[model samples]
Target: MVFSWIRKKAADDQEKLKKGDELVIPNQFVCPISLDLMKDPVSLSSGITYDRDSIESWLDGGNFTCPVTNQVLRSFDQIPNHSLRKMIQDWGVANRSYGVDRIPTPKVPVSGIQVSELLFILEDSVESLNGRRCLELVQKVKKWGGESERNRLCVVANGAITVFSAAFDAFARDDSFETNANLLEEMLSNMNWMFPLSQLHSLDHHHTEAAQARLGSRDSLRCLVWLLKCGDLSAKKDSMIALKELVSSDQKHAEALAAIEEASEVLFRLVKDPVCPAITRSSLMVIFHLVSSPSSSTSMAIRSELVKMGLVSLLLELTVDSERSTSEAALGVFDMLCDCEEGKEEAYRNALTFPVLVKKILRVSELATQFSVSAIWKLGRHEKEREKVNIFLAEALQVGIFQKLVLLLQLGCGSVTKEKATELLKTMNPCRPELECVDSVDFKNLKRSF
Candidate 1:
């Protein structure tokens, strides 16, 4: 398993490089202290070169002498050995046949001055009302982010998130989405890779930074909503995707999404007339997070708004044969909505609702099956409508769902799911056709009645 390490180790040591499998490392490439190829080979004042980390660690530990030469160092400065670094890179490339991964170039530290300059230009552009300059600055920062992990951390540390957010607010105030379409797209693309939205939520709402972040979050979300409304087909999809990226997978953005009263309406409009399959899924996700909330009573208002917006039928339409992940997401949200009496009624308004839930079982995934079975049980198990309960059960059986449930139980599932499956089976047991070998079991000698 020792590949050797340079900076990797396997061909080298764990602290230095990836150990190459039995590949002999160049003796010179190996650091004197760590005995591994140096990523940032540096020469000490003692005229010895060691891996930068190894040497620096030694110095930081208050050792005044070189580990190899044992000479007292007059100065602790370690000069970067660029030539040795290049040689290491070349050796790695030449030894690729021996399973040596090419050594990546060492990252240079980002300077605070450099990040400050970038931020200044961005702010200047905002002040001058120069759309062109602002667009260029956005592109430059994006390039920095994409260039290296070091650069991204530096930019983010220097308040690039707050700056880009202010840009969105500025553009929103100007109402220049059409004129600045290209810029908007690039910024959205940039935010996708560089922005850490969790930072927005972690702020203390009373602090100044928190106020700035709140402004950023709301303004950026508003800008995305605006794009969804006025942009072209491609832009609309991009904006929806950006919305998803901003909200992420958590309910952290529940209040943010709900506060933007227009977001739900705009997102629902997209779902009803999706620009693409991707947008439909994104809209569903946003709407799901907006409501299908974590027992937040206030979120119920958002749920009501969506249900009134014809969400029930829209979701049912999306639940059938959709991509696996999207299908599971839609079904999950649909199942959550079923918790409410109004959502339940709205769903029942569609005759295919129960049937669709049946179709998803065992066909999609375990989670989808769980959602489907749970919704069916919640809606059909009790005699909510004593008259129609039999009809619902019949419809479930008509779609071969009884067999699906049996199959689900046979294949095994979670305990809650097992309980629901058992209860539904008992409720619908009398309706299933009898056969000894039908459900992989012998003789239907068991009770014919539950």
Candidate 2:
């Protein structure tokens, strides 16, 4: 009875194909991973079927469980779903007139034996004359690994990070810059993949320490700085991202990065460049992480370089022209810089700093509002400079900064930030009549809060 019903359905499908109608393949026939007809369906220990290539790639990427069931697999073995494959083939045959292509059998996936052999080759290449071969193999692995999460796990499982790190160390040790350039480029490219994967895997402390050590080395630092200056766009972006990851992972790493003389200048140039917004953002992130450290010396070193580089002027420009996130980062960094006297002096010297900071209040994100308020308070608290304070207050009144602060109290802000805003309004008491007369109901309520 079931066989007869199946035959009837097949005949009906063929008739529909003959009439030039589109036949929708059953959802079950589609591979969840690829979202297309499964070429070589296979079942895992968890009883979930997937395209052989997709599942194998997933497993190879270091996943120990099934993608669908999320159940732990007893092993990496996959059994071909021959019955489902036949059904799909039959469907394709019946729909040939409807432009349905036959799903060809897939090739056998990379086996454990092959992975072991590749690892052995990588290990041997460290001291061997097969550096070119080693690079070629690494490139192949990188490309393959990038194709699927499965391949990425396989690469990681095979100790790819350690191999690539060693390769970088080896290339750096060689004095022949011209000779090792290609090799160095390949190693750096591999890092682009390795770093993210390491983070994904939540790599053990030893591996993280090893990576940090390699990146912190003098040779590695010089190479990265050189890459930022001389490498192509992609190389520069990768170097910046790698630096960001290193600093984000550890404060000690950030301190080490800031200690490099070229770090600040190179990052500043990237920020000022208008071509690649991504690189600019990455550069900003690296700077944020550097100054975000608690160490006073680190902040002072970065702040001094930024002040000399005229960071205040650049930040003012970004706040006006760049996106909200960039503006927020600029403000955050600006706020940190203002913690030191040199930073405050530099900011005060920039004519647009106060005006730009005032303009951002209540106009950007909440975080931007907080940073802007803090910055204004920092600048307005010129107790020793009574003359400057009066001059700044007069300027603040003219620019309507006092009016904005009054409105801010009515709008509500964090307690500390609101307190800062309230205090700033009091400091401008000499101009209170000017501030209060700017409006009626709202201005009266703002004064009562003060």
Q: All candidates' TM-scores?
A: 0.67, 0.78
RMSD of every candidate to native, in Å, equals 8.5, 5.9
Model 2 spans > 4 angstroms off: 1-13, 16-36, 44-76, 80-117, 127-130, 157-159, 175-178, 196-198, 406-416, 435-450
As a whole number from 0 to 100, the lDDT of residue 124 in candidate 2 is 85
Best by lDDT: 2
The global C-alpha lDDT for each of the candidates, from Candidate 1 onward, is 0.72, 0.75
Compared with the true structure, what per-residue lDDT tens digits does model 1 show for residues 147-254? 766577667666666666666666666555577778877766665554444564423333324324543376666777888888877777767766675565345656
How does candidate 1 score on lDDT?
0.72
Tens digits of per-residue lDDT for model 2, 302-413: 8887878888778888888778888888888888777767777777777787668877777776789899999878877766667766666666666667878877887778
Worst 10 residues of 1 by lDDT: 441-450
**Position 130, candidate 1: lDDT:** 86
